[model samples]
Target chain A: MDDPLMLARVQFALTAGTHFLFVALTLGLATLVALTQTRATLSGSAVAERMTRFWGQLYVINYAVGIVTGLVMEFQFGLNWSGMSRVVGEVIGAPLAMETVVAFFVESTFLGLWIFGWDRLNRWVHLGLIWVVAATAYFSAYFILVANGFLQRPVGFTMVDGQARLTDLGALLTNPTALLAFGHVVFGGLLTAGFFMAAVSGYHLFRRTAEADLFRRSMRTGLVAVVVSVMPVAAFGGMQYAYIQPTKHPGAQESAAQVAQFEARFGPGDYTPPGLATAGEVLMEVAWSLMFFLAFAMLVKLPFGRWLERGRVFHVLMMAALPLPYVAMISGWVFREVGRQPWMVYGVLKTEDALSDVGAGAVAVSFTVFTVLFAALVVVNVWLLARFARRGPEAVRLGAPGAPEPERPALTPTF
Target chain B: MQTLALVVLAVLTAGYLVLAGADIGMGMLLPVLGRDGRERRLVIAAFAPFFLANEVWLVAVAGVVAGAFPGLEHALLSGLFPVFVALVAGWVVRDAGLWLRGRVDAAAWRAVCDGAIVAGSWALALSWGAVLGTVLVGGSRVEDGVNAGTVLGLPLALVFAAHGAGFARWRLASGLAERARRVPGRYWVSGAALAALPVAAGARLPWSQVVSSPEALAVTAVMCVLMVPLLAAAQALVWWTFRGRAESPGYL
Candidate 1:
């Protein structure tokens, strides 16, 4: 516990884990918000509009706090793992930098516009901004996975003067590992959102809240999102698992062969990902199975809306299942990251070698500070979201569509 | 043409520093400039729409360094880990404060968030300036496996305050704008003097040696020379364009 490397690992894991909770929800919910808004725009239904505004408030709340975690994550690289940046900055930095310029800019800028444009812009234009937000969110995830993919399976790089440099951008983008991880994450994001939407909607529905039409529509949308996302999520997770199994858990001869080959080139040290068979992987599988079962049960009850609607017990069960996706996602990430143990860049660089030389006390202080801050943020964020979620769509001050119009709209037309 | 990426990087960095500097400056001056909670909310509302997007330039700057000049990023970022960690922590608190202020109704909560905003702003401003000062002075050295530099951190922070005041002068109105206008004059002299310490100390470190490419160094030198004047002109233009008090109170 006193070891700097161990402390650094704990700090990274805690911060990243907490950050991911928000990200999974943000990525999932942003899409649903966009889609719900689109449905409102096309149908001009009041319930759909209410659903959009209600869910959108939750999305904005999560996004506001979630965005800062990413900045913290970036800081950790320089502070905790400066060695990795020094050695592989050229290769990994490109994708990261591109993500900021291309995806982060587009997502943040359009999200601002989308938020403020609610009362200002034309219906279609407002709708377009949200779609842009959704698209760019996925785009940002793509670049991040590209960076992570390089760690999983280094590609499109050449060792130049003791530093790894990008030799081919095309190869980097098309890396199979990156593609698989991207698919898994994107679908997982949707599942996270779907479950969240369902749980919130179920609570309101069970209690017979003021906005029954709103909750009912939201429940259906959430259920549809869950059913649609689960299949792809499972498939992608399986593909990624299949891809990693051989390398992660090599045959006896394969392990010896890899060690022999790596020893000649990289000098010495064990080549396999430590703890080939880990509990995290087993837990991930179990969580995935539970998610599949839950989703299937919900789907089976989809036809008998009348019967299920009356079943308060089923509604309560749905509420309880809300945390299942989060469990699956965390376990999956733990398995993937921990499975790559000892190596920060697979066979290229060892994790121990990539640690900065800062003292244990400094790292310990930072770890403690970050843990406290992240925990506080999570609590505050949840409280705020719950307050608003309970308050219903009317609390959203963006103004409902049917409300009396102001004498003059302040926003100027941009297009 | 060959040094175009480097030039782009410099321009992006300058843009982030100027634009984000103003936004952060407002946060730094929150306690003094804002008399009450209403005034603080009013102040934040003015820049709320665009401030988050303004951070893109920072990401772009990092991108350029990591993508185009990995060696420099490694040298600079890893060298200034303490300042960066402080900056990130400041950002987290600042963002939380800004985002949470309107969400809760409790006066105590609002007050705590306001305090966080001020503290976060100070940390960010000081750290950002220290990073730049460290670079210009060439006094950065690795000591005890940590980045330590001889750059007087306060000067850079003062410079940011001046920059932020200039922004406030343009974007703000009434007594606040007038107060903001007085800030640069009060601080710029001292900041300039403090900044000179770095130049004087690093007088022997040739710009050509610090930057490997002659063309890139020339471009950088030109940008550095043009920067202050350009910022001044832009600030003047903005002030002229937005001379009167804001028409609407805040974001609708």
Candidate 2:
């Protein structure tokens, strides 16, 4: 019973972290496809047309996986944190309401159309629908993020009868962390999408199927998107850092006043949690800055512009940059969450106060199960992705002009 | 204060169903809305493919009630067992019929399954609205000191269902959205009147809750006031997005 909060936190953390992989990639790639496909229509490139179908397929894969994993987090809030809900549910419920009513439905409607409208609907309108769908995906993430930011640094609510109740709708809407968090998160999405695009294009380049032009263009789109997205992301990361630096929640800032409290409890060898308390954050900030440059460099994968020659080095660099955003974002997230430390929902509840009744063994078992499952997904995703990568814009290339049409793989010849 | 909180909770709870419930109901109605027997069969074929996934919310809510408000849980779930029975019956029968319809692909079996889905959807919508209605209208004659209403015009029940049906139509297909747009005036009329009742109830409040905690009351009032215009805007947005080109798949 006492450990319920702990269990919930751990579970939510794991689920959120895992699901984010899908979301970041989805947001990044979905919009890119829309933009690129629109470019294709106007530019009249068969490669760009095939590119849309290519990236759109990956988006579908990511979105389907995300839809399942994301559901757990929503349910866990009610299942695990009912105590919090009864209190701030009025305001807390608003974004969630909008998410279901507007953001989610909008995304679903267009997503359904985009996926099934391959040959259906007018091309530009079809493009418009996909764009709307992509926008809604980001919009959905923003509202959920705002709700989370509120939890991290609650505002616009007043305490009545010893429980906090919402007192300002506008305040909740403009919660200081909202914009910053969204900026940081949406940029991360672009990085994920860019990496996915780069990897597939890299695969095609390696297999020597319809090379140079398509792969280089894909690298340009992937890299440029990441580079452009970095501006808002870096700005947001800074803002989020500032927001979490203070502690107004009832003596939450023990480090400021009582060196003794730290010394007393974590005394003998307790220099650890404090001395380098912000190390992860500092490193993450540096990492993000470096990745921003790497993304820009990746844009030179095009012929003779020379960020690097179109080969192994460029591919490796792009792949390396791909994981940088992943690391930087996750580290920054960790810094924020752990930095908040003692408080669960700031100013209202203490983290230690909320552990469930479960025991260490149970926690260990469930943790093991979740980790194994997540790892299996990663493995399966990689292998499956590799197979699809080999298939590369090749099938569509069979009909493209001036191209030595791709030969089907030997393994699955129509026997 | 408790009454106001309850009222807010009732509204939130009702909205939860009206919005997400359509997702569930339409999934159930998937097979039935098929073009011919074949397309309908195919539609039903993939319908509710991962249903347990979507139903997680209902379970989550129950867990919340049990964990957070143990007192409320017993009073509510136990006392409302009959209505609970009907709600569960609907969820289960619809689910089973969906599966059975697949296995027993005969037209009769398919008809039975589709009928069950529609009936279950009606029951699910009504039970949810009934619960909201009882909370608002204070239930009919309080047996065992628990409010249990028969669920007719009780406060906001009909309006909520109308809202649910509207959601159902919008979620299904453009054809359904068109059909919903053409739904009888009474449906929208009832919805408007029911939606208005809370504002009416709210206006007469001794202003006590407001006066006691002006700030909180102000926020609550703001939330309530916003609901009207916000809902109107959302409906308008939905219509605007899909208004033109009925023949095409308007993903506006």
List the candidate 2 regions with Cα displacement exceeding 4 Å: A1-3, A247-254, A258-283, A299-309, A354-383, A394-415, B1-252
- Interface RMSD for candidate 2 relative to the native interface: 12.1
Candidate 1, residues A1-415, lDDT tens digits: the string is: 8998988988888878877888889999999999899999999997888888889889989987678877777778777887787678767876776677667766876777676546656789789889988998999999999989998889888776666767777788888889999999999999999999988888987888887777777777788889999999989988876557334654566667766777898888766665623667777788778878888987987776555556788678778988889988888888888878768897788888888776677687778877788889989998988888878887775434222223333322222
Best by TM-score: 1
Candidate 2 structure quality by residue, lDDT tens digits, A1-415: 3353455577767778777767888888888988888988888888898878767665655565566456545544443444445455544565665564446645764665455444545777777878888888888888778677787778887877755666676787788787678888888788667666776666555555765677777877776776677777777776775676453222355444443444465434222233223666777888887876776665444435334224776675555555676677666766766666555676466555433323444444444444454555455455545555566665432112122212221112111
TM-score of chain B taken alone, candidate 1: 0.71
Report, to 2 decimal places, the DockQ of model 1.
Answer: 0.28
Where is model 1 chain B poorest over a 10-residue stretch in terms of lDDT?
B207-216
Candidate 1: tens digits of C-alpha lDDT, residues B125-242: 8877676566654543422223234255676676666666665665564545665665653334433443454344334233222232222233323433444344334334333333
TM-score of predicted chain B, candidate 2: 0.55
Fnat values, candidates in order: 0.41, 0.02
Docking class of 2: incorrect
Candidate achieving the largest lDDT: 1
DockQ of each: 0.28, 0.06
lDDT of each candidate versus the true structure: 0.71, 0.54
Give each model a TM-score: 0.85, 0.62
